[model samples]
Target: MNFDEQTVLVTGAGRGLGTSIARAFAHQGARVVVNYRASAVSAEQLAAEIGGLAVQADITVAEEMDALFTAAEQHFGTTVTTVVNNALADFSFNGDARSKADSISWEQFDAQFQGTVRGALTTTQRALPGMRTAGFGRIINVGTNLFQNPVVPYHDYTASKAALLSLTRTLAADLGVDGITVNMVSGGLLRTTDASAATPEAVFDLIAASTPLQRVVTPAEFADALLFFASPWSRSVTGQNLVVDGGLVKD
Candidate 1:
């Protein structure tokens, strides 16, 4: 919980889960970099409130990520040692509108992968030099529980997150020698994130009723699991997927 010397960068931190994660890191005394692809206003406002830097960078684009880091280091007076890959593709959580496996296009799947897997890879790669030089780093990827349960069968979204989990483990193995720990935090349908806003109230109620906790997880609740990864307490933990869906997946 003490992140005094860490410089944290959170992607898509303009709103929702990303916003919550960034806030948590800032509150814990980490010099936070709020990276936003859009939502400039919200991102800037949050940065001002938390005393962090707001930078615009599309994680999918390498050049933009470079600029983001350069700007962050210049502004924060240090390189980023902690990264939270929480950016998500622009997709509404309307189960009724989601495409079936047979009807889903490869392009749709690719887009999700670009946001979840590729974006994480790009950010991780960019942060490596800084982390390597500092001899410490924390890479926490935000993921979904759909891959384990697949209750809604969001083929494209679920497939992309599965790929992300694979990357998380490999990166953990590769970076362990460099004092960097890579891990994932997976959550089920959150109570009310921008992505989940389109989900029906009845659907949310049904999901809550099915879970042992009788409630959907909150962004803040899932974000705390992410903090465990970045904190010194999890010094020996890596390459693991921690599900934060109120025991819905049991992983």
Candidate 2:
């Protein structure tokens, strides 16, 4: 996990899981670009603390994504060796039961899909060339294990993550020849994050008791799977989804 001189660009790095991932890369000695759509203050604070650069960009916008990469090259004087797509629309953080397939509106589904799939697609498209030139790259998409076993009805979110896994596999097939590997790490419900704050304590307790680890995974624990995909150890692996749900979704 030592990335002494590598440069990594992480989206949605202002807080939560993104922030933790950024810190992990920095801890491994990689120069990191912390990208955020808003929350300039927190993003900047994280960048300063990690000795990284904070670049503001809306992942759904191609121009802004281009600017983020340009700034990364300008600051680090090298192409980014790793790109982690962790950004998504600022939707309801709570995993409240949403629309059912029969009742869900197209707009709701589209809004989530655009952020998860389209945003990741565009960002990777922009970064692939640089990755090709460098002859190495790691592209890890943050996914959720909820899609595999949907205990809660998060129609839009679950659909988008499933789509993301498809994108990951396809991209890996298209880019593996160039040394750019695409992969995904899907995790079960996490505690304390805004996304999980609304989950009922009783439900959390039930799942934890049933799960092999007997607890929800933390952001740090989830990030460890991401790090494995980015590390040299996974060089031969690509287009695969690794479940980090403490055996909750064991295949």
lDDT of each: 0.92, 0.87
Task: Write one digit per residue (lDDT tens) for candidate 2, span 1-251.
Answer: 24875788899999878988899888888899999987799999999999999999999899998999999999999998899999877665454565667888989989999999999998998998898898898999999887889877788888999999999999999998999899999988876565577677887787788788899888888877788888888989999999987788876
Poorest stretch of ten by lDDT in candidate 1: 1-10
After superposition, candidate 1 runs with Cα above 4 Å error: none
lDDT of 1 at 182: 95
What does candidate 1's lDDT look like per residue over 78-191, in tens digits?
989999999998888899999987799999999999999899999999999999999999999988899999889999999999999999999999999999999999999998
What candidate 2 gets wrong by more than 4 Å, as runs, is 93-97
Q: Which ten residues in a row have the lowest lDDT in candidate 2?
A: 90-99
Choose the strongest candidate by lDDT. 1
